[model samples]
Target: MFSYNVNEEIQLRLLELRHTDELFALTDGNREQLRQWLPWVDGTVDTEHTKRFIQSTLAAFAGNNGIQAGIFYKGNMAGCVGLHGIDWGNRKTSIGYWLGAEYQGHGIMTNACGTLVNYVFSELNLNRVEIRAAEFNTRSRAIPERLGFVQEGKIRQAEWLADRYVDHIVYGMLREDWSMNGQASNRFEVETDE
Candidate 1:
């Protein structure tokens, strides 16, 4: 398991099967709001669905393909953030994340993402990290922008929401950019369970 102490108020932990119930409830409660930007909302029917998702992420972790972590706010499961998958040969990865509705505006996701970006560049030694969000979802898109990602372009009708298709705005960050930004104040520690 991988964990990060982003700060005193925000922490991240590997999403495990045991967290299914709470994660499910969090998502379910924020379903309408989340469904607008997330494609998998409709498929997440219950705790069982959450468990399967966690299991797949565990497999991905074991295979060194990806990592999915839960965002814990003040010791409670508040959201999730992760690398959807990494292209080892290219040293690139795409990040995906979502926070509970009530947890928004708390700066949790931003700190969590900053920590993950730090991990990607400093620990994983990856070259590029990408974040894609619906064009209309300003809040989601703002994360990558605030993290100093460059806006690459937009893909028209790139993703389908429940009612319609939405354009996707792509943002990318390079290892070079991170190094010159001065990281002395925002480094995070990664702890793994044996």
Candidate 2:
């Protein structure tokens, strides 16, 4: 049970079976908007599907591969942020995240992402962390950019979002770069129960 208080208003907690209902409702309510960016939105047609997703995230945490955490804003589920997986041999991992449309413009995703980036460099002792966003998704790309990640490269036709192929812009932050940037110091009071 990992939990981190990003601020007085935002908290990140490891996803659990109990979160299925709220998670499903959040996704369902935001289906049309989320469908534009996330490919799995259509596949998540029921709470059972959301349950399986949570189950997999738990398994990933148990296996020490990575984690998927739900973002809580003002005590309500707002969205999710997570690592895709970790390549331990290479000391690197990539992050993915999304926020319900109603939660946008509040900087919730950016702060949540910063916390994960800090965890990756300090707690996980990983050398590099990457965040990839669809080339046209300025909101998504802004998170990494706001946190000082470098624009590493781009992969054409990297993802199939709905009916079309979308290019991906890769952003990367290395442990050394993070440390040198001074933002490495946790800006928010962090609490973790594992």
Best by TM-score: 2
Q: Give the TM-score of candidate 1.
A: 0.94
Quote each prediction's TM-score. Answer: 0.94, 0.95
- Candidate 1 clashing pairs, residues 3+ apart or interchain: none
lDDT of 2 by residue, 148-191 (tens): 89999999999999899999999999999988988688553333
Regions more than 4 Å wrong, model 2: 187-194
Alpha carbon deviation, residue 166, candidate 1 (Å): 0.9
Error of 1 at 15 (Å): 0.5
Provide the lDDT at 87 for model 2: 99
Q: Which candidate's lDDT is highest?
A: 2
Q: Each prediction's Cα RMSD?
A: 4.9, 4.2
Query: Which consecutive 10 residues in model 2 have the weakest lDDT in total?
Result: 185-194
The parts of candidate 1 lying over 4 Å away from their true place are: 183-194
lDDT of 2: 0.90
